[model samples]
Target: MKKEIIIKHLGVVLLLNGVFLFISFLISFFLNESSTVALLFSALICGIFGVFPLIFVERTEHISFNEGLTIVVLGWIITCVVGMLPYLMWGGEFTLTNAWFESVSGFTTTGSTILTEIESLPKGILFWRSSTHWIGGIGVILFVLLILPRSKGQRITIYNTEISSLSKMNFRYNTRKIVHILAVVYISLTLLETIALMVFGMNFFDAINHSFATIATGGFSTKNLSIAEYNNLGIEVIIMVFMILSGNHFGLIYGTIMLKKENLFRSSLARTFVSVLLIGVLLVTLKLYLSGTYDLLTSLRYASFQVISLGTTTGFATVDTIHWPIFTQIILIYFTIQCAMSGSTSGGLKFDRVYIFFKLLGKQIKLLKHPNSVFVSKFDGKRIDEKLEEQTLVFIVLYVAVFFATTIILTAMDIDGMTAFSASIATLGNVGPGFENVSSLGNFASLPDFGKFVLSVNMLLGRLEIFNILALIMIKK
Candidate 1:
């Protein structure tokens, strides 16, 4: 492994983070918030550390898979650590553990926060918080790769590490084009959402912040009540629309917008994803209405938003779902585990794997009836590779095992069963909020420090995908 290459690439990532931190510093300076010095010092620290590596390390044309894995994993750890500086320095509700938790949650786009009084923070700090989501939404390495003047081989190697294998299945483009498509789609959605929110009566700052959270599917709302603070139905509808779009494959969105041949309309998986979400909405809405929790119209509105929000892994809340029927909560939990599509901003056990898992099961059933018959599982008209199938199955099993273990740990830490289980799934799925204590409108301030650390690890595992971390460990060994 070329240690210098890894260091150099990580330096690039830090420099990119420095750029965002500098932007936040400017925001603080303009607003005259107390966080001005904090943001500036953080930016300088990033810049100094980032530049130091570049000063010594020479450019390389290629990186081995092991080196790429190291760079990606270590890069994320370094970025998360640096991201906490401003929060720590600002020092309101941010203790060392809380800062680390919030920072990891931000960069991983987990949306699980520890801030008890979110709105009490200054505008600059709040912008910095949302900026972490946007920066992390596409991934730190991806942003670095986009800007780095590197060999195609080097770019492709790192890109492979940054992007999920399942997400790459739909793309026909080369690595360069794939990178471009991701950036273009990400920026376009954020810009469009910002404009739409402003038109729907949100002020400029809040609109842009919400737009960042929405497009990234990060769910860091500017207000304490999340979308519920804005009682406008139009705003809710707009956010819901974008949340659903953001959950699907960004390449498909780009293709659809560009009138390409294989767009969302032509993709079977996209159709199924949307269809399942619609079914979830129907079930939840019906339960809410029948339970006399809300009128039909009100139930539809809240159910639709929460279902889509959590379904997409965005984690924004339009209502406190803790008070909802147990049936509706279970349905939402199903979506939380299923998560959004691959190639999207959202993370966790992607819906693609769930879809594949069911198809794989059906294939097995067919084979049982005729011993000599060969059954092939197909996705989007392509024969699924047996190797990929095995990996997906193992991934699902490992995902469940990890979260189950986490739930047990949290429960042993004296958290209630529901809260512990839901928290495990929420953080492991990179979906924010759980039932009971960590409800839709609730924060994660009450969990023990050890539990918070465990969940932070869960966030990284979900964001990086389980196999990458396992592969890294295996490679290191």
Candidate 2:
């Protein structure tokens, strides 16, 4: 299976992580923080391991599908392992399980955390944490693809493995161009958000970190109260704008910026996604206001933020939604399951699939009424073939089964039904905060170690998109 080629590519992933770790180390070193040595040591470990393989293995221009898949899967597992090193060594709230959970959550951009006192951590550690989101937001393998000076075949192989077919639906470019589009859109959004935050009186460090979290849709906050700590309407408005943008397809964003044909306004999927989010906001805001939860403006503020936050799978909280009305919570839960667009940073059961699911359902209903009629399902004006349609349906079923299985496993751990169910979907959707014990503004510190571990696996499954891991397993068998 071209094991050497796999190792070489995986080494690149580690090296990329090592670079971020070193940046974190420098932050700790300059600040004389407690995590300095830990960050430094972790960075060194990544560098040494990363370099050794590159030194020994000759670079190959071509990689098999199995090798590419192995590299992509193992690359994430390895990165997560190394990611926990700083937390494990720093040792404040980080036990072994806690470190692993935090690492998985970070790289998966799940935003779920084990820290009870997030503000107590060193700046370097916090930066490293946010860095994980940025690195993983676009994907570690995609970063490697950008740097790898390989042939088109090599790039395409890894690209196919790293990105899903659904994500590539709107991207009309070749492999290199597609990767470049993602990088450009990703970096531009991050920089723009950072500047906006700083202009609104956020300090540079916090601004950049929050930008990393926002553009990545990763939801990790520098403060304990998340965006609520700022309490600035301007800041909230800026983040909400970016959060919505980040949730849309990056290619569409690029196209819109470049005045291309496949822009967000031209894409039906993008329009529907936005419409659904607005509808969610309206429903939640109306309920909050009518229930006397808050005045109209106040209700609109919190409801819009939470709705968009969870809708995009960003998970940042402007309010503690646990105290909200049940109808509002259910609406939020629906958004958690129906996450953002496919090509964006946010993960989980993407809104595109949900859109397609409904379309397919309508097609089936029409067929029942007219037995001889042929019904064709299409998305964004493109025909959906039977094969892709079957695959999407299978994916949805698998997604449901996996989350339900996780819920069962968590319940077996003796967690409350609400916590277990919400946590299951939350982690599986990579949507961070859930209701009950793991609600918005609450940490995962109270969960059993095994439960945290299970959720960590859920985050990985969500990030890997179910099929990749299953394909890898089949390859092994």
Candidate 3:
């Protein structure tokens, strides 16, 4: 297992995180926020640890899949450790546990928060929150892999760890090209959203921060009420459009931008993803209207917004859903579990997996009907390997099991069944927000410290993907 090589690669990740911290510090200083010292100190600490390895270790030409797995899993843990330092040092709603929880939430792009009053946070700290989304949106290692100028042969394996299987379908390009395409699309969308927000009268800083959150499908908002605080239909529509786009595979967005044949419009998986979301919106809207949760138009508006928000793994809230009917909440929770596409920023049991699961179901039914018949599962007519199908199924079971276990633990701690269950699935899916105590507008501040800690671990496990962490533990001696 080339431990030194893994350390060296990890050092690169630390350095990347340090750069972002430095940026946050400057923003803090300019804004005269109390978070400056925290950001500066965190940056220094990251720099010291990151650079020390460079002095002791030599560069390697390659890493094994095992080593890559170790670097990625450990890299995330280390990144979260480092990512929390500023909040810890700043000392507001951020005690050690709170900092770790928030940092994990940020880097995981879960957008689940523990703070009760987000607007009370300093601008620099808020920017740091949005920055975590930007960094984690693509992935910490991905940022390193994308910006760094070299190959270690295990690039695709690392990328697969960082992204998801479903996201890679549209990319026939080589590793470098794929990274380039992802970067271009990510940056372009962020810039475009920022411009749109600015035109809607957000200041440059708030617009940039909000754009970062939106493009990442991260629900961290400059305002406590999130995009709702804007009160502009234009802003909401712009956010919604981008949210839907960000929820799809970045590779497809790249294809469309590059004028490649396999664009978003052509991908059957993407079509189904949106179609399912629309249906969910329609259902939730009808339920809300029938129940008098809102007028017809208002119900549709909030329903579509909330549906897409959770559907994409973004956690922004215009209205608290804790009081919404159980049926509406169930629909939103379904989207939360079924997150956005693999190639994009959203995470969870990706729509691709759900699609694959149904296809695999049909394959099984066919096999039962014709015992000797060959049944090859397909996604968009591409043959889905038996191994991949098996792995996906295992992942889903593990995901549910973990969620259930976490829920049980929380329930034992006296958290309600609904809150515990929703929180468990929310963290397990890397989708932010839960019901009751941790609902759309509610925060996790009141959770027992140990419960918050457990959920943070769940967030990391989800963000890393279950198998990657498992593979990290099972590396051959």
Question: Each prediction's Cα RMSD?
Answer: 2.1, 2.0, 2.2
32-98, model 2: which lDDT tens digit per residue? 9999999999999999999999999998776666776787789889999999999999999999999
User: How does each model score on TM-score?
Assistant: 0.96, 0.96, 0.95
For candidate 2, the per-residue lDDT at 95 reads 96
lDDT of 3 by residue, 181-234 (tens): 888888999999999988988899988998888888888887877777877777
Counting clashing residue pairs in each candidate, in order, gives: 0, 0, 0
lDDT for residue 223 in candidate 2, whole number 0-100: 93
Full-model lDDT for every candidate? 0.88, 0.88, 0.84
Q: Across residues 393-439, which tens digit of lDDT does each residue of candidate 1 receive?
A: 89899999999999999999999999999999999988998899999
Q: What ordering of candidates by TM-score runs from best to worst?
A: 2, 1, 3
Residue 398 error, candidate 2, Å: 0.7
How far residue 196's Cα lies from its native spot in candidate 1, in Å, is: 0.3
- C-alpha RMSD between model 1 and the true structure: 2.1
Q: Runs in model 2 with CA error above 4 Å?
A: 144-169
